[model samples]
Target chain A: MDKEKYAKLEQKISPKPPLLKNVIKAFLVGGTICLIAQFIALFYMTFFNFTERTASNPTVATMIFISMLLTGFGVYKKIGQVGGAGGAVPITGFGNAVVSAAIEHKSEGFVLGVGSNIFKLAGSVIVFGVFSAFLVALVKTILVKMGVVSW
Target chain B: MFSIYITSFIVGGLICVIGQLLFDVAKLTPAHTLCILVVTGSVLDGLGLYEPLIDFAGTGATIPITSFGNALTHGALAEAEKHGLIGVLTGMFEVTSSGISAAILFGFIASFIFKPKGSV
Candidate 1:
């Protein structure tokens, strides 16, 4: 068989993922996480003197905390496997990344292993997060100073 | 209130769908996608765009990593206003300290207790 024919033959035999099922699963799981977060924020707003805007910080912190606990118990990995991007695209995934790295590297010893490698995945997140924020802030400040756009 | 909930759900779900598309079509790694999201959030927040999104979508907008970046920038800018140049140094991390510290602390404890399921 020619190369193209051989490739097509191989493609025909390969198992296809259930794309629709996975999308539905992802949508449900992701929406569930956001729903929980929203509830938490509402709780804070109702009981604590926080407005909708102010409640976000505590809501995110609580979600990350819950994710870390789940990661510790080895539950999050299962979630990631089943939920795929649904499990990961939220802040919980960020928690999983940090804790999983630390767990993976724990055998190498404390400071160098757990400490250093803990941020291996998340470090990029923080670095880029801060850098991007700085750049945008700088541009905003310049534009405001020059009166190019009034804020 | 009901409309807010519906919008939040749709927006949050859509963001995840976009992430899924990136993973499937673009084959971007999770880390790369996350970084991109954070950067996008920061840029939008800095441009004063994300605030409106937050107003419209609430937790739908905030639960994503982009909101974290948005909070960092807003915190730093607020601090810079109060403390001048010194605020720039202390502001960003201060805003995010709770989340960061919690992750580190919980991660450290979890690592100490849990053994790897597979070869590290």
Candidate 2:
């Protein structure tokens, strides 16, 4: 069969993705995760010396820790299946990435296996995050020097 | 105070929705989606917009992976403002060091105690 004919046949037979439903699920899961994080941030603000601005640091760390537990227990995968990007888009997802990679490579011993593979998914995040952070800061520094904008 | 909760939920959810669309419509992998969002966050912060979003949405703005970029850039810029050139390198991780450190420490513990289960 020609490529166009095969493409048409494939399109006709393929099951449609439930885009709307998936989007709603993602929003709910993602929003709920943020709501829980909100409370965590508030807890830090109320009980500690942290202000609203300063509270996110602790809040993110706490969320990651919780995700570590969830990932370790394998519960996070269920959440990921249901929540899709909702589960994958938050700080918890970053923690899950680290833990899951570590768990996957546990057989090769700690040094060659877990240590090297621990960052397989998340290493890009840190590298690009820091690199872009440097670039942004560089631009802002030049802007400040020229009085184009305040820091 | 009450409005903050609503804003956080809605805004945070919307960010995820955008990611969902990227997956379904754009067909990007999770890693690519995350990298794109992080860079978008850095661009927004460099444009001086993300802080206002944080002011508007509270945890709504901070909880998403995008905020990781925002925090890192904010730290670098803050240091750059004070110490000029070298400050950027020093401050790149000032705010996020705790989060990364916690992940590393917990990762070690998790490896020691936890076994990977059957595939989900």
lDDT of each: 0.79, 0.89
What clash pairs does model 1 have? none
lDDT of 2 by residue, A1-151 (tens): 9999999999899986689999999999999999899999989999999999999988988998899899999999999999888998888888999988887888999999899998899888888888998998898898889998987
Worst 10 residues of 1 chain B by lDDT: B80-89
DockQ of each: 0.58, 0.80
Quote the TM-score that chain A achieves in each candidate: 0.84, 0.92
Candidate 2 ranges with C-alpha deviation above 4 Å: none
Give the local distance difference test score of model 1.
0.79
The B-chain TM-score of model 1 reads 0.83
